[model samples]
Target: MLKAERHAYLLQQLSKQGRLSAIDEAERLGISEDTLRRDLRELDMAGALQRVHGGAIPRPPVPASYADRRGDDRTRKVSLARVAASLVRDGQVFFLDGGTTALCIAESLPVNLRATVITNAPPIAAALIDHPGIDVYLAGGAVAKRSAVTVGTEATDFLRRFRADLGFIGVCALAADAGLTIPFAEEASTKRVMIEQARRVVALAGSDKLDIAYPYVVAPTTAITDLVTDHTATEERLAPYRLRGITIHRQR
Candidate 1:
């Protein structure tokens, strides 16, 4: 496989199993141990993995700044964003949680569709400026410098004033056991409000986010009505979600 493809495979393995066996990954890829080592070294240098003797372990995922996360899963986020946008209809008021993928939804919105977007992310509100049909509302609060999002009590309280038809939330990690989660406590708190206030909630995540867990819990697994992810995810990896009756939409 190509380097990019191998990198995705390696990370996906880390997401699922949390560590790698050099022998197993090498055999799985049908590549020599030397080539696998080189690949692991490259990924380590890129801050994608932590290399160790004989194998690799999941690099302690320190959530990067929004700018960094925005570029990391561009393809998968864009694909998932497209699917999320498809769920919106004109004249609907929706809640958009802050993140790179949520920004993608704003940018992917249809040209002729008219809707109202209420968000804690200034970046996402700014992205909709050119979309003539959409109305944007910005919730006021302390802005998170790294994520360019509103947080704190002001933002959460402001969000409580409006009820939305749909809520498109971005998560740092997702697992059958952990449900939806993020590293930021304030962000997780805001998301819980969004979930309770929205009529239908959709959580958008890249395939790599599956089976991962973060520091704070946003909500339980049953809180979300649907999940949208990239087709890169295997059915085997998605079985748990399906069994839970959470409708899964895989972007092609």
Candidate 2:
């Protein structure tokens, strides 16, 4: 068969079965394994599908802006933040990721809470100012206009200074195999540093982010200690991560 025919077949099979194995597909297409891998890699780079450990999974198509996201899911964000806040204990240091969800998490902290917060977002730093007992540290860097979060070599360099007790991560996408991903490479770089420096990491995501894959890979699902989500998530949607030992904390 021609390459176009093979591509069509691959997409059709993935649409029917949800995932595809290169070994099986190569045999079915009567193609060599190396050529099959090249095709799959091309497809992956073209954003057609996600190449996993041993197969490919359908990649589905973010919150576009900071203000829009902050205002988008007000109630659900609050609920997710409450779950994130519950994980915080007195005197523990935190690394807060930038986004509406992290803003919600920052806002949800107890007013009398005593803790140290280190973040890369200016707005997140500003939001935490009213918490009487919490000390906020803003990582210095040139801020990105789109997300209003600090990004660049400077930001990641600053984040490396402290080893946080807990890290609050927010993402545009989350998948069982692709892990946590976002669209911006700069943001992804900063998030990787946050995940590396934290002793424990808690991911705050909406149910809409689940089972989805974004372009830039931040960290693997294994990096998260706990996942705080809203009521929209189902057990089936969460089972893959749970099976891999990542704890899921849905809305109570």
Candidate 3:
């Protein structure tokens, strides 16, 4: 293929899959890896894609921000959120982790429900601000600019002081072997503290996030008591968690 044709092909594939690893793209296109890297660089410079460690992801249609991220996979997130919200009980203290999924759960919370929600997510805190029966405690710490979540030793320390009845953790990725993994180191530490301080940990995951693993391991597979996912998650994919005695809830 001509150079222009190859680049166009790469852009098409990225549009379909949302991302492509350099090695994988090279093999698929029958091009040298160096050539593929050059193509990726050209595309990156053109503002067509964002290059990551070993892959390129599609550039957002507009300038990307945290708000943009929260809008993706809205349907699946809403389903997962509804299932997660159903697990909450009145008069309980709950820990809400910071992520798009957790934000969805906060939005889906019943207005009349009574509970104390502790979180580091400004978005979640804002969503609960007007609830008369629900009290929200925003954890104080250094804010993570990318995720808008408070993190570091201070946040983790505050979490350890209270034992929450339940925790809703949002994960970037999950594998049967790798458990829950996220991209950031400080976020992993904060999530670990939430898991430890809660009596029960409920993970809110979308189907697309399953079977994927990231660099930082937040918690082991055994740490989670339940996982709520969208209806698209198959029984075969959920078998491993079931075998490990974790309840799997699918929302249609």
Candidate 4:
């Protein structure tokens, strides 16, 4: 088949099945595996699909700006925030990532809860400022105005200076095999450090963000100790994360 014909077939299959196995599809198409892989690569670059270890999946939806995301999934984000807040403990050092969901988590924390929160998002830090018992440390770096968060090499280097008891990451895209991913490389750098330096890493993602892939990978799904998602997530959707030994925390 011509390359365009092959690309169309691959895309059609991905849309119907939600995933593709490189080996199996190559055999079906009567083509060498290397040729198939090349096609997948080009498709990925074009933003038509996301290439995983052995196959491909759909590309994730484009994320909204920081301001817009804050209002996108208000109820679901609040529900997820409450559950995530319950996991925090007194005196624990926390790495709170930047994003609308993380801001909600900061707001949901108990007023009297005593803990140290290290964050790169100005909004999250601002939300915690008046919490008498919580100590907030904002990371220093060049701010990415669209996301309203601090990012860059400086932020990642600063995060390496301290280890935290728990790290809460705002996930852009998550898949069982492709792991945690985002579109921006700088933010991915900071999040990778948060995953590495924390004793436990919890990914805060809504159900809509699952089963998709983004351009920049943060860490493998195994790096996450827990996942906090909304109630709409089905057991079928979460089973792969469970198999990876990631404890699931759903909104009640």
Say which candidate scores most in TM-score: 4
Best by lDDT: 4
Pairwise TM-score winner, candidates 2 and 4: 4
* Superior candidate under TM-score, 3 versus 4: 4
After the best TM-score superposition of candidate 3, give how far the Cα of residue 16 lies from its true spot, in angstroms: 16
Q: Write the per-residue lDDT of candidate 1 for residues 222-250, one digit (tens) a residue.
A: 88889998887788777878888889988
RMSD of each: 7.6, 4.2, 6.2, 3.4
Model 3: CA > 4 A from native: 1-65
**What tens digits encode model 4's per-residue C-alpha lDDT throughout 151-226?**
9888888889889999999999899998898988878888998999999999998887888987788899999999
**What are the models' TM-scores?**
0.77, 0.79, 0.75, 0.83
Cα deviation at 35, candidate 4, in Å, is: 12
Query: For each candidate, what is the lDDT?
Result: 0.84, 0.85, 0.83, 0.90
Any runs in candidate 2 off by more than 4 Å, and if so which? 1-59
Locate the minimum summed-lDDT window of 10 residues in model 1: 52-61
